[model samples]
Target: MAVARHVADTVLFEGYVLYPYRASATKNRLRWQFGVLVPPSWTAVAEEHDFQRTELLMEPRRGATLALETRFLHAGRRTVQRALPDGGFETVPELRLDDRVLVPWDEGHEEQVRLTVAVDELAGPGVVVPFTRPAAETTEPVTDKAGRVVGRLVRRREEISGVLRIVTGELDGPYTTRRLSVVVENTSDWTPAEDAGRDAALSRSLVAAHTLLCLDAGRFLSLTDPPEWAGGEVARCRNLHTWPVPAGEPGTEDLVLSSPIILEDHPSIAPESPGALYDATEIDEILALRTAALTDEEKREARGTDDRAAAVIDLADSLPAEVLERLHGAVRGLREVTTSGTPRTPAPAAGMPDLGPAAPWAGAGGADGAPRPDTPWWDPGADASVDPAHDHVLVGGRPVRAGSRVVLRPRLRHTDAQDLFLDGRRALVEAVLHDVDGGVHIAVTVEDDPGADIRREQGRYLYFQPDEVDVADPGEAS
Candidate 1:
């Protein structure tokens, strides 16, 4: 085995063909992730034009091909980002990406961005990929009243190197979404070592690892259900403000926060890096902050009432169809995993490069939607379509499979003007539908809708029914 020569931003093996990390069944080793993260700036682009995110699952084999999903974020999407100082509505657009017509997130919408690699390495190297710290999920896990890691939310954070790779792809509408396969794989010439040295990549990765483990330890010892990363003097909430969207549209969403958070330095608390703060004490605090900020934005939209609670509820009534599209896959229903669109995963050896898809970070129309009449709280909401013990069933008695495309047609108010308007405009619209007591209970949730019905919750329902509208085949995202 020759002395290994390190690559600047990649993994290298002895002479290109590196040996994979052996399985770890006995003890736990440093968790690792092969995925790459786009920077924070990409959110705006992702939300505005609409893009998709494809999560790649590494097989036991060295590599796999993934496709990108298509998406378009309209007014009501709730995807939010708290890390951005000014809490604002964010998005998780699933851009249609394939082998041809491939595009990068920055191509049309360039802004600050970060792409976090995603993988589940529960067992070991093959079973799980470490990187997960910078995940942009809107919600976070919390502790129980007794101060133990409870089972309300399932959040797994894996750490990886700070420096990430960049992989771009194209997404043309219609028929097939292709992938960009790495035709040329690199070879290394270094000998495998029981211990790897601390190179730049290794250094960044270690920093992330230390931060996460410390966060875990801290969260484990949290004293607040709504955790606060730092607590000393009770700071006044008066100055905490929000950042409005670029345009002052009555119902546009906020993509960033313009407020100032006093990062008071505390020698007592050791930070992994400068300004690297993790409020592991509780995830609810962040959620609350996000909600408040979103509320302020909704009020600014003036689409309806001024009450924060009512505003948020009304905002969710007509979520942008683009947001749903991002999470749905065409064939495998795997959230659009195209070769270029999928998250970049680091192959064990140097040269196996993967830059996770950068679609979602393309634009910013982040989701501050127009307000509308909300479904009554009494509504049971959409039924959980997925159960580990059960199999996939057709929604609303409508046959569906991995590749099924279900067009929705909401039940509109019986009116000559409404019929004439729909017929003259001929616009595309869709609402979710699920079977009930025989006929489909088309949910209604529009400003003037009287019979619209649909309930929204996390991880519980998959279908929604928009009332007093129409459903057409998903067309090419404009």
Candidate 2:
């Protein structure tokens, strides 16, 4: 089960939420391929003639060689005359975004736009222009007007399109340098295809070059890999995510580069490393609505076309029956944890492998393969603490020791914790534990509650990552 949870994490690792999750995000509408070198004309800009410069963070190790593979698309453009209301003649560049680049331009000035793509490699104060096309014979030192040698112009040719490879010697390791750019410059005077013709004129121009930076396997495995003990689990988690690399030729080893790292802005990970990508509490609440029991009027509200409720209802219906049943059982267990009641652990469904050994902390069964009588799931006796002597753990960037006041910071999703452990409300950090997967978690007992024998009930402690808590100074912990 723990392994299964890691597998789920792997699947949700990349492309889970796109750059802009909502349709309202207009600024991030276009999906730009990472590190792609494309003609300036293909991009949308208020000003004319600008190249799309892609910058990526490079983590190159010391004493290791590197190989960079770049793939680009070929786009055909034509100069067309558009009549303006002011009677001025304007030559508009039209790009074929689709496969119809062979059709004659509207004004018959059709020509395959010849382009020169160049890659500049930089580290520390040094620069190397290792690749360019069409090849350059007479080369001169080129720098941005700022007098920086930046990178060499590898090649400049009239007709060149496809994958380019640049291999380099061992790079100086143990370094972090942002040359600010590993520039891929397309120096051509072609205009981007108009948006109106984009759907039909999809050509090489529409696709951007995908650059891959790979290191020698031997060197990379030894120096940069995570600790050996955790390597198999990490690989298991990553193996869940299988992104397809774009292939240039059928048998070619070089493929389009893709990354699991979320390069864009996103919320920080919860300190606890909640195994699932979603809020289980919210899912439980939605499940509690019971779509099968809704009245016609309530059904209309559940299926309302305008908002998120309809989507939630749809998702609930689409989910497997076994999943909903498991969720129901989970929520019931949670209810038992918050209350001063003894909740008997449920038996494993028929044919399902026992998860008790994989997740010793779950404490569902004892060594004899029988339910542990009267044992709280959150009890420390289930698994030995990695650091029990330390009375406090770091929470919200502050050291919050046990017995100190803390506040809940549950996620924005609809959750039962929001009501029980309201944000900004003070709570008590009773205990802290580090799980088998090396994640730190703290058990919090709410300061104010309506329950029987809260202190005596071992199940009353709620666990969360340190990030979800803050120090509740003096009076805050009433």
Candidate 3:
């Protein structure tokens, strides 16, 4: 559960704030963009949704109990006020007290609701858990060194209500698998006016909502790569907005995390990460280095923006040399390289040549088993065989080179969301390139694109692997 929670926290605060972490930044103006569950009224007038559903397949043993934890962020408005001589406070965007400065910002308050139910009980009507948090406001006085109250910070939280419903149904097959469905809906009664902006709707919404499920007995199956027997059942499982993935240890399946972000099974945080920078996609090493290079005024503004931003600034300023070095990079594993730029394996009888121990630059060392000082690995001129313009790859038993026409067929597991749009689209192959790791990639431009010629002229084309595309009209190309 602890390991799963660690990964969930990353999802919870993703994009909480972008780099620079200042309120003045243009990108930071409109926030709370991920996993937001707004009121139903706003959904009628806007594109945002009001609910998220996650369905997974589980095989439970006798007397197995399931525990569910729904977690989210409740948006709060923080207003900075300055005390007037008449014993009243006036709302201000920024307030300064001695060395500290305060700024008005929208903050997130963590909210969690938990429930446990036996697997047998889930056979009937299942379970319903309704939770609510009432509206509240608090003020903290900001004083100087003399302890004189100069201003105040008022934080207000809007009332929020939501429901978590769980149900189970036996899957039809030889297996005893059960389909578990969990729905997290925003039941907040507040209805915004037609012209009300996003800020008003977000106040009563569930930001970054996610669910964590654990079973005392039995385990959950992987929806991404389920067993052959459960493939049909897994396909039948309907998941909306969120994706369910196995959590906890690498091989363990007792815990599952249903996150709004897509993730592979058993996703773990990198140990080299110092902490959350709110921008999960960016490299921490680069962000840390960039943050540490901010000017004094920029750092001050970032610190005054939000508490989390302040913590990030402090973390960047205090990271040790050793920790920063670790953040540079990490190598998971290494593979042996043959004379040809491919993974080493037993030489075949016909095609491959037996270079023996005298192969040049073989195994990261020269023929004498010593580091080759004359030839460096990163030198591109050292390898003369890789010519993108002349290189070609075989697809559908046909040689595909530049000007070859191919149809995109992106693999489901290895593609991004944007690549789905390119599926089945006809493209003209521009080049067949190879990476430093000996992987072949086919670069192409969409045939119907208006700027295809411009992109080709600029040497900017979409790249796909050899298997991700199919040769079109082999006879015509030949």
In TM-score terms, candidate 3 sits at 0.73
Candidate 2 lDDT, tens digit per residue, 1-478?
A: 1212222232222221121122122422232333233445544533222222323233344443445433443332223333345654444332121211111121101122222222234333334343333422322332445664422222122333332222222223344322123333444444544553341222323233323334332112211233454344324322111122322222222222332222212112232322232222234534344543545444343332112334444554466666655555332112122122333444342222333443442564654465542444355443343344354677557787667778777664335645554776677777666654456777777777665246527555667777777777776426
Q: Global lDDT of each model?
A: 0.22, 0.37, 0.85
Off by over 4 Å in 2: 1-29, 33-36, 40-165, 170-189, 192-208, 211-379, 382-448, 452-458, 462-478
C-alpha lDDT (0 to 100) for residue 475 of candidate 2: 62
Candidate 2, position 413, lDDT: 36
Q: Write the per-residue lDDT of candidate 1 for residues 252-331, one digit (tens) a residue.
A: 11111111121111101211111111222223223233333443333233221112223333433333545334324333
Which lDDT value does model 1 have at 476?
A: 29
TM per prediction: 0.15, 0.31, 0.73
True lDDT of residue 16, candidate 1: 13
- What lDDT score is found at residue 244 in candidate 2? 24
Which regions of candidate 3 fall more than 4 Å away from where they truly are? 335-478
